[model samples]
Target: MLKNKLATLLIYLVAVLITVTFICILADIIIHGFSQISWGYLTESPSDAGRAGGIAPIIVSTALIVFLAIIIAAPLGLATAILLTEFAQQKTIFAGFVERCLDVLASVPSIVFGLFGNAFFSLYLGLGFSILSGGLTLACMVLPILIRTAVEGLRATPDDYRFSAAALGITRTTALVHLLLPTAMPAIVAGLILGIGRAMAETAALIFTSGYVDRMPDSVFDSGRSLSIHIYDLSMNVAGGDSKAHAAALVLIVMLLIINAISMGLAKHWQKNRIISNEIII
Candidate 1:
């Protein structure tokens, strides 16, 4: 009992520390950033080498980059996760090999992905430094994370679910499509959300694959700059652009937080409905 209480106290203390840190960081950014966020700043395109005007193009480009990345990554990640959890033998050499591959993949530095994107997608495939190239690069980067989280989610489903399906004479394929997939939706979505966060904030990978164009993208072939890259350009390269960078950082943080909240809410809502529907059907 004494050990249990001590462990509980330690967990609470760690939680408090993390909460306080986040609050402090948010307060600092918002204080410096809120004043810079005007309607014109958000709606007008930047001018005078990023020293004047707004970030309208930047916002649009960032949205497209994130959208493409998600579309490219989610399907591949889900397929891999399903294959590993539902098909592969748990104790087999093949399973062990794949797990090791994921471990190494997750540990690879992001900058290396940028180089690979530049060499392969940008040059070899002739996609050049375009939104499509960037999206594909980010897809590769997000795969490892999604695979890890999705595997956990799939494994979390109770064995009884499979037993019940078997008892009902449901085909394995049908059960997977109708029951297991829906039941695992929340976990899969949670992984996708994390992937979104990583892809959205990624700079190095986009640096090589997504060009530093300040204008809004007209097509998938067009090059674009993301918010994170915009922040880097203003803060590091441009003179007298700190205020705008701060404003962009503030927007990025708020956007991420909002996306996270909405994704989580949707996942939970769908998961609940799926559970209800499955219960009725069974």
Candidate 2:
């Protein structure tokens, strides 16, 4: 009984410490961020000296990159997950190898992805330093995460559903489309949110592939910088003190929070619906 109590106490202590650390970080960000946030500051664009301009362009560019990256990553990631979970049998050696390879790919660093993007998309593929190239690179960077999450979501669905659909003489494609995908919606949505967040926070990869253009992205072929890259440029290379960088960081944090909140709400709604459906079936 004493040992069990000690172990429980240790777990609670660790949990509290982690919570405290996270709260401290959040407090720091909020304190610093609120100081730099103002109507005039957020609305205007930066001037040549990184002063007098609002962060409008940076916000716009980041949105463009994230939106385009999600558009590209979602279908590919979802399809890959569906294929792996629904079609690929675990008994096959090739399936096992592919799954292991995906796990390895997920562990790769973001900078390496940036380097690969710079070489293949920018130079070899001749896409040049454009938003499309950058988005593609980010898509690849987040693909493994999205795919794995989606696979887990798909796999988490009860096996009985698949068996029932199959027993009803449903085609494999039809069963996946109508049954499995709907059941895995929450997981897929969660993965998409994560992918979007990753795309938003990426800096090194975007720096090399996207270039440091500060204008609005008129097309996918146009060059632009994400919020992360913008913050890096302002903090590192700009002549001013770190004021603009701090403001940009604050904005990025706020945007990420909003996205996360929305994603969480949606996931909860989906989960609730799933529970209701399951109860009804029972």
Candidate 3:
């Protein structure tokens, strides 16, 4: 009993410490950014000093990139996951090899992706530093993440469901579409949310491929900077350094919070529907 109590105490202490650290960081961000934050700053375009500039362009660009990245990553990732789970036999060497390749892709450094995007898309493909180029580059960066998460989600479904569907003489494709994908929807959505978060926060890849244009994007082929890159530029190039940087940092944090809240709300709603579906199935 004494040992158990000690273990519990240690666990609680660790949890409290982690919570405290997170709260402290959030507080620091809020304190630094609160004074500079206003509706005008959030809505206005870039100013000469970036001090009075709004983050509207950055917000819009970030959203567009994330949307495009999701559009590219979702179908491919979901298809790959479905193929691996439903079609690929466990003993197939090719399946194992493909899975390993995805792991390697996930582990590759972001800087390498940045360089590749700069070379191929920006220079070789002649897309220039445009939203499309940057979006495609970010798509590549998030592809591995989405695919892995989707695979995990697919695998999380019970084998019993697939076996039962097969026993009912359902075609493999039908079983996947009618049973497996629906069962895994929550997890797949989770992966998509994570992918969007990563794409929004990415800086290096966008820096090289997206360009540092302060103007609003009129087309997918137009050059633009995302929120992450905008913050970097403001901090490094803007006069008076720390003040504007702190303000930008604060805005970025708030935007992240807003995104997370929306994602979590959607996830919860999906999870509720999933529960209802599962109840119906049972």
On TM-score, the leading prediction is: 2
> What's model 2's lDDT at 116?
92
Question: For residues 117-220, what per-residue lDDT tens digits would candidate 3 score against the true structure?
Answer: 89999999999998888888889888888888788888888999888998999998898888888878877887888888899888988888888887889988
Worst 10 residues of 3 by lDDT: 239-248
- List runs of model 2 lying over 4 Å from the truth: 1-21
Model 1 lDDT per residue over 1-282, tens place: 999999999999999999999999999889988999999999999987677889999998888888888898888888888888888846678877888898898887889999999999999999999999998999889989898888998898887898899999999789889989877878888888888899998999899999899998898899999999999999999999988888999999998998789887987787789789879989
Q: Kindly report which residue pairs in candidate 3 clash with one another.
A: none
Clashing pairs in 1: none
- For model 2 the TM-score comes to 0.90
- lDDT by residue for model 2 (100-201), tens: 888888888888988999999999999999988898898888889899899999989989988998899999889888988887888888988989998898
Alpha-carbon RMSD, each predicted model: 3.5, 2.5, 2.7
Runs with alpha carbons beyond 4 Å of true place in candidate 3: 1-18, 270-282
lDDT per model vs. reference: 0.89, 0.84, 0.83
